[model samples]
Target: MRIYLAAPLFNDIERSFNERLTSLLEPMAHVFLPQRDGKLMRDLVDGGMPLEAARQLVFEADINAIRRCNYIVAVLDGRTIDEGVAFEIGYGRALNKVCLGLKTDDRTLLPSGDNPMIIAGCKKIFANTIELVAWLRGGFLSARDAG
Candidate 1:
């Protein structure tokens, strides 16, 4: 099984979070992290390409990876969920892939008790990593055994 980790990677905290998340999930399945693994954008910018072009490259790469992945693990912890992460989760759900939303933040943003649309799309939502990883690994392994 392969997992697409969708999260904001703009700052050090977000980057570290994504890295740790990938490490935790790597043992159970192949992990495709848009921030860490999307080399095209970094390479393009490093090679002196325009920021807009680099963004496009990164977006396309992530969308393709999301399509190929069997599951999506999205970190929704923040004052508001990242736009890209939300879109990726929605796209993954539209493709019928399992999407797990990880919301570790203590604060809730929406007064409607989280966006019904976003919650509707996720197969499950987890506030902690341990339980989420265990469920993910168990489900994948059980499916493999069944097949």
Candidate 2:
């Protein structure tokens, strides 16, 4: 199974989260993490390429990885979901790939309710790592075992 992990890679905390989750999932499935696989921007920037060009390199790589993966695990736990993560979820949905939202944030964007669009986009929104893991183990992976 291949999983495309979508998250903001702008800071240390975000990068660490991506790395930890990637490590957890790597043994069970192929996880394409943007921070790790889409490091072309950092590399190009260190090589003196313009920041905009480096950004484009990352954008192209991540989108292609999303299209290729069997599923997408999007991190939605912050003051707001990262725009890139939201776009990845939408693109994955458009591609007919399963989208799993990992939102551990207690903050709510809308007090009344979550956006219907985000609600419907994800097959399920997991509130924690344990919940997410149980789901991965109990859902499609089990189906694969049976088949």
lDDT of model number 1: 0.87
Among all candidates shown, the one with the greatest lDDT: 1
lDDT of 2: 0.85
TM-scores vs. true structure, each candidate: 0.92, 0.90
**What tens-digit string does per-residue lDDT give for candidate 2 at 16-134?**
98899888888778999887776667778999989998888878888889888988998888766778888899999999999999998878678764666776899999898889887
Q: State candidate 1's TM-score.
A: 0.92
State how far residue 110 of model 2 sits from its true place (Å). 1.9
Clashes of 1: 0
* Tens-place lDDT digits, model 1, residues 65-108: 99899999989888788888889988998999999999998676
